[model samples]
Target chain A: DAGVTQSPTHLIKTRGQQVTLRCSPKSGHDTVSWYQQALGQGPQFIFQYYEEEERQRGNFPDRFSGHQFPNYSSELNVNALLLGDSALYLCASSSGGRREGHLNTEAFFGQGTRLTVV
Target chain B: QKEVEQDPGPLSVPEGAIVSLNCTYSNSAFQYFMWYRQYSRKGPELLMYTYSSGNKEDGRFTAQVDKSSKYISLFIRDSQPSDSATYLCAKKRNDYKLSFGAGTTVTVRA
Candidate 1:
């Protein structure tokens, strides 16, 4: 069985440009969450999608958005990218659609798409 | 202040030695704690997870959480060169989003 998979292992974009990164969640998983990991730092949550709707979001601005398809794949779109937006974008998949009680379900992550803004 | 604070240690240790890593969180409401390992140019992989204040051991890894102190720890026993990577500590409340600490990079020298 394949784990989480992300497209375009690496990307280069210019300021004010938009970039879209894709992800396919692990088999049997229904939820997808995106994270941004800057240099020398841990990943910061961007947002999470369930049932094709955003259920949770982080501190990111409106420029960062995401979509989840019925197939459980996800796409992260960053508009008007800034130099600071350059980082490794990670996609993680979990089994629960909506979490309740204790969250014991483990999340699996992909290798991540490296985005560099020049 | 950050929700979770971890020392970013480029810690170097000899192979076969025990490696210790720690992180502290500002929120007492964080109930789920986890430790993730990430290699260079790679995404983090979950290594250990615990919901309560105690130690959960799996092979060479042991995850410890102290709710009263709002601290978490991960210990690697008899580490190997392959263990060299950045270790991230993450915490989450009853909500869906996970808050992470700055990762600690470890290099196990042979």
Candidate 2:
């Protein structure tokens, strides 16, 4: 069985441009989350989508947005990207069951997309 | 102060040594704690997960959570060179999001 998969292992973009990263959740997973990991830092939560809606979001600005499809696939879009936005964008998949009330579930991650804004 | 505090150490140790990584959080409501390992330029992989205050051991990896102190720890016994990576400590916060600490990079010299 295939685990979580992401597209465009690496990419380069110009500052102020927009970029889109895609992710396919692990088999049997229902929810997807996005994270940004700067160099030498741990993954920072960006947002999470469940039931085709963004359920929870991190402290990121509105420029960082995401969409989840009915099949549980997800896409993260960054508008007016800044050089500081260059980092590894990670996508994690988890079971949304019981997530509404603080119940936690294990998350599986995909190999991140390395986004570099020049 | 950040919600979670961890020492981002580039710790070097000899192979077969015991390794301990820890993180402390300010939020007492965080009930689920986890440890994730990430290699260079790679996404993090969950290494251990613990609910509430207690210890859970799986092979050489052990996870411990102290809810009273708002602290959590991950211990790796008989560490090998393959274990050289960045170890991150995180907590399930706000139900779906996981607040993470600055990962500690470990190098096990073989």
Choose the strongest candidate by DockQ: 1
Cα lDDT tens digits for candidate 1, A30-85: 99999999989999999999899998999999999999999999999999999999
Question: Tens-digit lDDT track for model 1 on B10-72?
Answer: 899999999999999987874689999999998899998888998999999999998888889
Model 2 Cα RMSD, 1 decimal: 1.3
TM-score of each: 0.98, 0.96
Task: Name the runs in model 1 displaced over 4 angstroms.
Answer: none
lDDT, residue A78, candidate 2: 98
* Runs of candidate 2 exceeding 4 Å displacement: A102-104
Every prediction's TM-score for the first chain?
0.97, 0.95
Error of 1 at B101 (Å): 0.8
The TM-score obtained for chain B by all candidates, in the order given, is 0.97, 0.95
Instruction: Report the C-alpha displacement of residue A17, candidate 2, in angstroms.
Output: 0.7
TM-score of model number 2, chain B: 0.95
Q: Residue A103 of model 2: what lDDT?
A: 47
